[model samples]
Target: MTEDNGGWIVFQRRFDGSTDFYRNWTAYTNGFGDIDAEFYLGNQIIFEITKDENVELRVDLVDKTGESGYAKYSYFSISGPEDFYRLYVNGYSGNAGDSLMYHSGQRFTTFDEDNDLLASNNCAEMYHGAWWYQSCHHSNLNGEYGNDDYGSGPNWYHWRGHYYALNSTRMMIRVRRY
Candidate 1:
């Protein structure tokens, strides 16, 4: 839960294909995986923590070639289950490009729950992971580990294109001191 000597609480992490990110809604909601390894910090807890406070989101990415980049949002939050955990984010500033902004205002989707805007396909099921998807996503860190194929692996589309699977990804958040 600690990184770079900061109090950033990691919400999700992906690296080698050691853990399966392609899980059901309950698993994603209640949380799963080892904290020292790949995991999602659970949507319910995320909503509880950020609902009443100002939080900042940071997404770090390392591409297959070892190049790295990051994207930070000044404000971030999400609505609860009744609204499908709708995403809300703004004020982007970083080197990774604004991939997550495209997913802002979208709803979380899973193989068992299709809440994305895409009418024909369940983005989570098609992409092999769960996520806040809007007509799919520009960033899908929960996808199959190391797959690298289109819609099949963790990706920050703006940083390396959709087909280029990233080497690693970390999504972290912290309460804004101000």
Candidate 2:
């Protein structure tokens, strides 16, 4: 990741939704200075930026084949001459149901209900509701350890991950100097 004129940071993410190969994406900032891009996908990549102090960027992926796989998400935090931005990347597996949360600092912006939110003004909120709820393993008892509410109703809270349990959650935070 590189910084442009002012304090803009640019990063990229590989776009290979249909294929199996790991594609490599690139990001570049403009001369004016600003966070050019945070997360890039599809033909037209999207960028999320914020001026706040606390915000988050949420991402959800859907796998139709039911095959277990993993993907990588990357971001670059750029700043001015005195301070430099950092690159943060994490690996997320493509399961039936998986949710990944990233905290882009309090100064960043947050995503809204729609997945097509903008990150330039504040933090952009990107949600994969269709994919997130459909892919994971759900139970009525919220996927609790010894709860008998298994399969009783829709398990909207329970999520399968390393922690294991109904409260299993994932979050990422990216700090950039502005």
TM-score of each: 0.95, 0.22
Q: After superposition, how far is residue 134 of candidate 2 from its true place, in Å?
A: 31
The C-alpha local distance difference test score for the whole of candidate 2 amounts to 0.24
- Which candidate leads the pack in lDDT? 1
Root-mean-square deviation of Cα positions for candidate 1 versus the true structure, in angstroms? 1.4
Report the C-alpha lDDT of model 1 over 1-178, residue by residue, as the tens digit: 4544477989898888788999998988888999998888899999998899999998889987888899989999999988888999999999988999899999899999999999998999899989999998898889988886896799888888899788899999998766
Q: What would you estimate as the lDDT of candidate 1?
A: 0.89
lDDT of 2 by residue, 1-178 (tens): 1211233222222122222111111111221112232232221221234323322233222222332232223332223212212122234333323233231111111122212223332112111111111112221211222222432221223243323222211112334333
Alpha-carbon deviation at 124 in model 1, angstroms: 0.9
**Among all candidates shown, the one with the greatest TM-score:** 1
Error of 1 at 117 (Å): 0.8
